[model samples]
Target: MTLKLELEQYPFVDLSAKVAEIIEDRFAIVLKSKLTLACMYLDPRFQCALDENEKKIAKSYLVKLHERMEIKRLAKLDASPDTDSRSNESDNSNTRDENENLLEKMLQSKCNQAKNSHQKKILQLLNEFDFQSERTPTGIDIIEFWTNNAASRLELAKLAAVLFAIPAAEVICERDFSTLNFVYNKLRNKLNDESLQCIMFIKSNEEIFQMQ
Candidate 1:
């Protein structure tokens, strides 16, 4: 919507219209990006910031994505070699743990009385969280929050890991070149590739180490 509004504010309607059309076409592909969707879904800040309707949209895609993942998991399981005694024991142990988890959730739901649907539960948690206030006071502990909840939110944690692994923008590579220019100036020309990489890593994440 903001992008649309920005385009509308352009002086040339014809150019804006053409640009908007291109954006619309590209935006469809962006929407289909599971990694982006997963990141948005798992990010506490994004969850708190997005409106209810936007949350619904993310949830709809995430649910479908989860289902697709499950299908792939089952296919992989079917393709695996037959389990012997050791594997069978491991399966039994996993089943026991799962049953225990089910019992615990059953007890918790009974106490709560009204179990919301998965979608609503996620949205409710997101909406109820005071991420903005917490961020202003202390830094946003997004990784910690996800890590602590990872056991119960296993799929979301997996999604978060995959999403976080993706590069957010191509500009990062361009920025690295800029860093290289600064690091490999006339006096530093003798630095080898390995040394350059070491310097780049330190430069890129200097603030994080500084904080520690």
Candidate 2:
């Protein structure tokens, strides 16, 4: 709306041109970012941020991530060889050849089982929209909420755990820059990158010890 108003009032102005360019760049970044969509769905603050259409968009992306994770998990399971009857391998060779059809059927059944389980999880997430209405009597600890309910809300909890781990601002990066400067001075220039990182992590989380 601001851009539309600016275009109508200052169609020939340089500021309007700059604004248009900036809006286009920012819009492209936001539209291309799956993180933005994931954040919108998982963040309690954004429970009411998106309209119905936007919620649908968020849901599609969230479900896509969930399905992708599930597929990878199932693929890993499928790739794992059965080892239970390894001791009788020589005798089992003939049996294995005969049971190829049964093995294929079993593999198909497991794949279907995995897909069904994933679908159930997605449905649970969809039905749990009311999770937004559950008041956080004390305060908002989004990560803790999901972590505590992980057992019951496995898929949604995993999604929340991942999304919550992503820092929402550049403040942590800026702080790390300052810490790097302090840690890698002229006298400490020989510190390897690994050691520097270790020092920085401790410095950043030092407050955790103070809490005790």
Candidate 3:
């Protein structure tokens, strides 16, 4: 369990996601992971042979796992005046305890390390432009674009959104690349701008252009 949790850490979030996609086992593993936590008291033998004591212990362990996951979920809610004050306080404590999520720490550390050069460059450029800190433009869009497009520090962020939205991307790319290569290769020496356009039309199976 500790190893699984550790494997889940850092600027390395997409590692787990990529592995999960590659193996197609993340979902199946999660389902069985919960079962394993409760496996201690769950005898493989028939229940008819077991007494009430063993059954009770097995049920208790399973319930405990659900309770742990549930408490963590409830902790993420915004504080509300209407919230049950007692449960809300308990959730807050449980939330803090569960927040040992090490991924955030690793990401921040990596970002800090990467920032040394980029930040220095930004400061130097600003100084060169005669823009003092007070006059410098600071906005969310500017920073977002700088980090995402310029520095490329946040490229994994773009990929994470894509990975979550589209599973099994590697397989799709693998299947299409062969067809693209065949189309391009067949046009080799015969290819000029006009004929290349025609080949692309043929490659994409646009029959109207082919007829023309």
- Each prediction's Cα RMSD? 11.2, 6.5, 27.9
lDDT by residue for model 1 over 1-212, one digit each (tens)?
Answer: 45876997884789898888788888777756645555665776555544555556666666565556655876998786665855776658978788879999998887455323544554454444324434321256667777887897776766566557667678888888898899999998999999988999999888899999
Give each model a TM-score. 0.44, 0.57, 0.19
Whole-model lDDT per candidate? 0.67, 0.74, 0.45
User: Model 3 off-target regions past 4 Å?
Assistant: 1-159, 165-169, 187-212
Please report how far candidate 1 places residue 196 from its true position, in Å: 2.2
User: Candidate 2: where is the Cα deviation over 4 Å?
Assistant: 1-33, 67-120, 130-139
List ranges where model 1 is wrong by over 4 Å.
Answer: 8-12, 37-148
TM-score of 2: 0.57
- The number of clashing residue pairs in each candidate reads 0, 0, 0
List clashing residue pairs in candidate 3: none
